[model samples]
Target: MKTIRQVSMLQFTLMVSAFQISVAFLSLPRELARQAGTDGWIAIFFGWGMATLASAALVKVMKNNPDGTILDLLQRYMGVWASKIAAFIFTAYYLLLAYDGFMIATLVIKLWLLPSTYIYVLVLLLLIPTFQIAQHGFQAIGRYSEIVTLLSIWIPFVYLSTLRHAHWLYLLPVIKEGWLPVLSTIKIMVYPMLGIGLVFFLYPYLVRKDKALRAMVISNTLTCLVYLGITLVCYVYFSPDEIAEYNEPVISIMKSIEFQFIERVEVLFIAFYLFVFSCIWIPSMHLVSMNSAWLLGKGPERGHLALWCFAVAVSFFIYRPSFIDAARVNNFLNLAGFVMEFALPACLLLYVAIIRKVRGEKRS
Candidate 1:
């Protein structure tokens, strides 16, 4: 059957980039600093290489079952009950990811721009765009990702303005924290580079399947460069001690920029950043709905209110974490994300490859 909603190579790549690059923007540099200090960018490269291998494995598994997602492959190889169980677990994972983005974006806004606004109000405001894209399915989400990613070009330039205060000394004494800290940060970095695993859900919808892995590499590479650039800028622009003081060093760096034309450019930056941040939640919400729909042998249409409700219910309990609180939660999520996005996918690829080799031997 012809898939009616196939996404192009560019759109697929952009979607992955958008997802990897979004919510991580404000927190990533800070987290990297917390883990590895100024030597953090090295860890980013390590994480990027790790993500590259994981992405290739994910694409390979998808290539093996071109007509179906991992869920379908599980049913074919494992039992129906097992496949459904895996699907439910994956569905829950994406839902949790969606809510994570939702919570982070809301908290960022409350911290920076809309402190007077209620968390529930921010939740509703955020969900409006998320549901609009998710309900329309991957096509809309793809195009939205493309547009928002294009809009992200301005981010680098904004960060560039802060280089006026650049301190080459702060970034000096490379490996000052030793490789141990840098190595630890690799684990921290892996979680944010995780959006590549969405290939399981998105691969079947790719217009040109042959280019999917190539596009995955390109997306992840671009995201890696974006992280590297942001982290480097933060490392150079802020003192090592001062970097630790700010919760969101990327946004805090912007506060150093003073423009006669604009009163507080950081506020404007964070406000516009809400659009880029939406990239994470919108597509994730779609993944949750699509997984649920596919498991039931149904078309990938919308109206997945149950997942949205689950998100809202989660938000009530996860309400307005302090910087330390959010960091603790983020650390926990990163550990979980590493297991799901990298460890499990690598294992799945090995399992699928072995299954194929045995089948090929049988055929021979």
Candidate 2:
């Protein structure tokens, strides 16, 4: 087996964190309100707490098997037949997520900038460089992630400056629908933290010894806080009616900002958004490529091939014939994503814990 290059713990954390903030920050508030009404932010907090606990369990699984990826550990702990089934399911989920990332980028472009832009051309432009970086391996991707992380922090500051424009009165009458609505929204809120699952595949490749668990926990905690903050800000800024009416509430919030010299803040928002999209797309591409390479039992060259295949497949399949179909499909995919990303990891953690206990008792 050709060894994958090692990345630092900090790099791993930032790569995951930056990607989490990207798509979630742009659209989550709207999704939250649709599901949880006035108590959407509270649902987000609850979801984050659940996601954090699940992530910690996953990290424990990784730490127990220091040099093994989830696939490797699955095969060792379970039978070969069962492991193959699990691996295939996970691999499919990751590929779908990569495609979803591509689709989202194209969707944003079409909705906000150019209605007539070709999805394939946009996907091609984005993927070619991503393939090149994936070929360079994880270290290059990590460095790029670090740079984007610094830029991503500035986004919240920009959003925070728009607070004065937000209607604080909109956030009144908290949790009017009570606990049931808030609990229901957990499913939607937890989907944003799905990037945490990437750690199962990448943790074995980290350079730092025994720190993956701590790093991931800290990273996830910070991401959850950031997401909750952004969602709350949107909830307070826009009326429930206004939030439901807008597709991208954050961008709409930015549009509401104005000054004498700069006529539009949306342009600045788009530039930062492009940076975020890049951060999200590259790591997603990397995960798909690396996992595909592992599955095929091929050398590093196969990683390059995997990257191209993923990029091409997504570009072709993602362009819906109509905008309405695209929106419907995207919403369905987001809901499906909660299952693959959150529910699957939680199940895997449970499996691992059961196996460990069984093994311990047999030994005793």
Candidate 3:
């Protein structure tokens, strides 16, 4: 079936925000502290600025063919053969993206919630809801994003409770070394802020295409605030040297909070985050299936979904990657996602501009 333009801007913004949150947020504080010390939070704003510009460029590319996906624009400006190649590359990227998210979620579950469960079993359980939502297409995906965002709204406030003994003095002397360190960490910020590029695929489905740029900016802003808030909280809550010691300072901070009514709130928090992290992979997996079907000259169907799901299940079951393995995948995604999310959009915008100019001149 043909896709429909039914996604509202609010749903789009929430979906984009969820995409940016990813597994990266879990260790974001450690990443910043290790790279830039206390001044690392500054890099988030810089990253947000860069992500916003990249998002704007993507919107402009979509504007060139407002009613079609990137695949359609590629075919129009490049050629059929070129579009297929581009689709294949995109398919690979999204597939890897899905795997990275899925693996991270499984790792977190094993570490905190389900240590004894088999990896393949967890993969299968995760895929069930993912397939159900994704098979229905982008509209269902958009609504799922909206629902998850609303449900997760209170999570940030829970973080605030960790600040009872926070040492505001820990954040003293901004840029302790120099701008060099803070500026250097901006590259580390790239991977987490990447969900904006989904605009390339999501633009055509936007109901208010005129406000696509606005939605992109707002979503990036929301993501930035979440990253910034949590990073700053971790910085003040833990010593600069101590922050990097914990792989996930956000979850570690929860250990400080004690309640008579509850034990191990961090465990509950991690379990709840299973649902939050689902936001990352489900949409990506759907995109994988969608692009795969497009390459085969078929509309999205359950067959493509089943094929990719089986592949993911089998691969993880065989590999059974350890924590180090998952980290390596994340590292690879950091580099690959930068190429796809940041570098490619800028190149495509320039190429599309030149192509349009030449075509206009030819018509004249």
lDDT of each: 0.79, 0.73, 0.87
Considering lDDT, which of the candidate structures 1 and 2 is the better prediction for this target? Answer: 1
Please give each candidate's TM-score. Answer: 0.93, 0.89, 0.97
The better-scoring model by lDDT among 1 and 3 is 3
TM-score of 1: 0.93
> 83-136, model 3: which lDDT tens digit per residue?
899889989998998998888888888887889999889999999999998887
Worst lDDT 10-window in candidate 2: 319-328
Structure candidate 1, residue pairs in collision: none
What local lDDT does model 2 show for residue 121?
Answer: 71
Model 1 C-alpha RMSD to native:
2.4
lDDT of 2 by residue, 293-363 (tens): 65665667445456556656565666454446546655675677667666767787777778878888332
For model 2 the TM-score comes to: 0.89
Which structure is stronger by TM-score: 1 or 3? 3
lDDT of 1 at 80: 92
Q: Assess the local accuracy of residue 43 in candidate 1 as a C-alpha lDDT between 0 and 100.
A: 85
